[model samples]
Target: MNENFKLLNKKIKILHLIQHMKIGGGQKALTNIISSTSISFEHVVVSTFNQYESELNKLNSSFIDCEKKNILKIIREEAPDIIHYHWWPGFKMIPKNKIPHNCGIIVTVQDPTPVEDIQADIYISGSNFINLFQKHIDGKKRIVIKSYIDVREFTLKKKKNTEIIIGRHSTIYKNKIPENYIKTLLDFSLKAKFIIAGDGESKIIEKLNLEIIKNNAQNKIEIWPGEKIKEMLSICDIFLYITPDDSFEGFANVISEAMVAGIPVIAENKGGNSEQIIHGKTGFLCTGYNEARDFCQLLIEDRILRLKMGGNSKKRGLTFDHTIMGKQYDQIYTNLVKLNNKEKQ
Candidate 1:
């Protein structure tokens, strides 16, 4: 709502590039931004992987196709005021002839590697964590912009005795650590049900019969696979994420979502996660698997602490609401356009 941003109010078309719109943190961030903000500008997101067309359309997609000609044709017809790229790998495939499509490109860097070297008019990193690593390609505008959430989705909810760890089971990194979270929960002699709310883990999950152990004690671990997470997150008391050396986590939308759901989050004590949940306020942060286990134990026993932290988490969630993010990006876009015009003259 600044003067610079008002200049872009004439429905400027923006072309966004994405690897895919699957159920992942990165794609969700992109989807939320496009969906929540007021459409002051025309926008199209060309996902390389042709998934989630309906969701994209629900978010008001001007054009949702993922073909090469379709991409250029849409751009040529819309004549987008600026083409923004949020992906990395697909750029290599862009024919050199279509370089004009990207002549005024803006890319949002989700990580801190080779993506930093790519040419762009304005390079926006989702959080300072990624942008702080290396300076932008000299002279190109680089800024740290954090993703926002729909705080209305998350409010202070009373704690439920049912504890949950919201993540996948398969896919562990170096050090031969337990790759699957279901395995970790199964390893413990827990008294509460551990719900696995995502897919892939179910394949390996069935092989290990955790039900027998739960049946013996009249307690259980539930595997509710696939993406029906609204009630799961809303009712769950605790949420945890354990990963190693993941370079592409700028602002995990799940963290924002969980915060809105008023779940006390426990995550690895590194990277951009520090920006998400305030340590000991909204959530707790610890290093190593054992430390994470200890944190869960602490939350389970302390109801007052859990309720207080969950409320704080929801409060923090509102700070990142998408309206704020779009306004910030609008000003940055205006800056890029003015800079482009100044150079042209």
Candidate 2:
């Protein structure tokens, strides 16, 4: 549709709420979403925490930071048609009295929080498990819409001769240690270079004999951490997405990115990852942290199989795209708006 036509149809003001629009891919993806969706829809971001211009510009999002105001004043000023929340901390801050009575609520549940009891008029989850649990929701309009990305920006490159890469910096959950994965790579001792890309609390530099190439010493994991995310995706032959979370991972954006990049992945068979990556086809599921290195070795030895799986991953990732996700949100918003109007009448 043309820009003028889209604007002329009905411009619904969307107040997107997030805890912190910084740090992780989930947050970044949300930012990207608002930017892309805002072209057709009226959107305003309500970030509970920091709202950096640098970060906002990356996603092409404009907004009002929620930290400065009492709930009443903020809601009144924005006068949002709907409150589409992404993070839980921000959801808690939504005052009941301040909430617009006529406006319907639609929430995108990304991760399982410590929070319980609080509800949305329309609840959406990123995976099927969350969707199934929606039957228990008080609201009738619960749904699931995966957090998908623009696959075009992350086209699968026939990997540049198996230089496998991993983002291993700033580790959060130790149980899902990349050290176990590192050991797996070391065991193979293949000609293909294996690199850890993320900065971590672990003393990784001292442990690995490999030189930490200066991308930036501050983050530590020896990376060329450029703004261009797709370049990193394009070069990697296999991606290691081994974050071992037992209870929750609403969705694995990086795993999906790797798949979009068409790199074979090895993700732990836990949390939402099991749903994100199809076993044997998109990636492998490591049941043991102890055996991570063994799996790495297996891949290093097998070239043709690795490429075939990588090819499959790319094909699967296309199914998860922003266009599909956006349309689902469009339907939800349209339904919510209609429902709210009916209630008013």
Candidate 3:
């Protein structure tokens, strides 16, 4: 639909509530959604915590940084058609009676667990694998919509023939990498260059540094603060997505980003990673460190297989476009509004 036509219609006012607009999967996903959505939808972001200036300024919608006590007041005053809550913290902050019964409540599930006892008209999940594990949500409308990116921007870069670059980008605090996993990565550092990118507590970084030093793999292992991820993925030949046993990664956006950059991934067979990796095709899903090690080594040793898998990854990654994702959510919003109107009549 044309922008002018969309503008002429009665726009559905959306109050998107999240904990913070930090550099994370859910935050970026919401940003992509609002930016790609048609002008017919009016989006207002309400964050309980602080937001990154760059990310907050990027959106065209109005943003509100409010205290817990004021959140319900803002919602009631704004009287938005849809309350699209993302984070668990955001869900907890909602007061029961503040929202009018006719208002549509939609909760976007980004973690393995949804907020218990929260009343929502629709529950939006980012992956089918994550949705399968959801037990907290009852009798709510469920829809699976995977995270998306503009795959075109992350073009494939020809990796160095002599050196294979293995990269992993994540908030390390949530990652519960076993000591044995570190040893396994160090073992791979013997043949390939390893890059661990992401900012975390100083203690965690120091611990990782100590592990690298103890293994005498400092030359091959590079641990640094996270930068533009696409830049990191461009030179990377393979990606390592090993999270702890109890990881709550609803949809691993980093895995999708790496795939878009034509990099093969080897992820732990848990969380939303199952939905992203095509096991043995686009990438491998391993059950343990041993399995992960074998897959990593295979990609490192076989150049032809690496290229083939990378191509397949890109092909699969292209299927997840942000524009398409926005349209799907738009349809859900439209239906919810119609349902609300019908109930009133």
Choose the strongest candidate by lDDT: 3
CA deviation > 4 Å runs, candidate 1: 1-9, 68-74, 88-98, 101-103, 156-178, 199-219, 244-248, 341-345
What TM-score goes with each of the models? 0.82, 0.80, 0.88
Flag regions of model 3 displaced more than 4 Å: 2-8, 89-97, 100-102, 135-140, 159-161, 176-181
Compared with the true structure, all predictions reach lDDT values of 0.65, 0.62, 0.76
| Ranking of all candidate structures by their TM-score, best first | 3, 1, 2
lDDT of 2 at 4: 35
Candidate 1 local lDDT, 217-239, one digit each (tens): 22455655455466567567778
The worst-scoring run of ten residues by lDDT in candidate 2 lies at: 211-220
> Residue-wise lDDT of candidate 3 within 264-309, one digit each (tens)?
8898887877778899999999988778888888987898999999
Which should have the higher lDDT, number 2 or number 3?
A: 3
lDDT of 3: 0.76
Which is the winner by lDDT between candidate 1 and candidate 3? 3
The total of clashing pairs for model 3 equals 0
| Residue 110 displacement in candidate 1 (angstroms) | 1.5
RMSD of each: 4.2, 4.8, 2.9
